[model samples]
Target: MTFPEKVDYVIVGAGIHGLSTAWHFAVKLKARGKCDGSKIVVIDKDSIAAGASGIACGVVRNNYYQPAMRELMTLCVDVWESDAKNLHYHNVGYMQISPKCMEEDVAEIFAQQ
Candidate 1:
């Protein structure tokens, strides 16, 4: 594999989080006038965003039952919609589908987060 002469950061995973982190790092470097696609490289054992990000349904929502997760998920959604626009992102509008009953067990999901 060919590598860069110099690299600023190396993220292992090509999942959404890794890609987002790399994007933000590049954005910050650009904002500081330190970079414009310079010396920043993201390498995945596989293809970029070919893991979870590719298989995901790309749903954005804040209606989660947990507070912390809800906030993080909300931030993820915002970045996907707003920040992605600079790179030409089209928002298809996220939909949150709830179960027929609101009394289902959602505590585990929140707890894991």
Candidate 2:
């Protein structure tokens, strides 16, 4: 189809991040009666999910060396949990199998969270 001359939102990619952001925006706009599919446009050089997100194995984990990363991951997990069915997410939980040497470090990270 030919592209429209104007759009309310123009998403640059169709990868996980872009798609999720677009979905959230569309949801909010619809609630405000400000948008429908016609008002939003997602432009991607490749097919949806054909970028790094598609090649990378899907693994949701809260493990991170930085507190900020952990917090962000926690928030992401919450979003996934909120719409597990719609998002096709399996909240079966994650396991971090570590060697005895890293047990203390892992424990410390867990404690911080």
Candidate 3:
């Protein structure tokens, strides 16, 4: 593979955050009549999602207590559910076992869900 001698943008990682940032930035720049994404380059020591994003330990749930967080989670859930194939989103059910002190908050979260 060959890379250009000079590029407008250089992204260090190909992980989720890096790709998302580069994509959104490029979109905004193009919308404003700025540079196209051709000059942008994404480089990673390893392959894409070679970091924590490649791990399977993370969990996304709508179990937050705050209103804003809950709303954000709702949007995230929608996005995840919408693209199950490419995103590899597993809809495995979640189970939460908390102590007595968290019973109220847990119940509230359940109600919200």
- In order, candidate lDDTs are 0.70, 0.86, 0.87
Clashes of each: 0, 0, 0
Candidate 1, superposed: residue stretches over 4 Å from native: 76-113
- Candidate 3's residue-wise lDDT over 3-98, tens digit each? 789998899998888998889888998998988887788999999999987885767877878989989988988988899789888888688999
Best by the lDDT measure? 3
> Which of candidates 1 and 2 is the stronger one according to lDDT?
2
Per-model TM-score versus the true fold: 0.60, 0.71, 0.74
User: What is the alpha-carbon lDDT for the whole of candidate 2?
Assistant: 0.86
lDDT of 1 by residue, 3-36 (tens): 8787867777878788778888889988999987
lDDT (Cα, tens digit) per residue for candidate 2, span 1-113: 89899887899999988988888899988888887757888999989888998898777787787899999998988988898999888977667899999998899888887
Please give the ranking of all candidate structures by TM-score, highest first, separated by commas. 3, 2, 1
Cand. 3 TM to true fold:
0.74
Q: Lowest summed lDDT over 10 consecutive residues: which window, candidate 3?
A: 55-64
What are the runs in model 2 whose C-alpha is more than 4 Å off?
Answer: 82-105
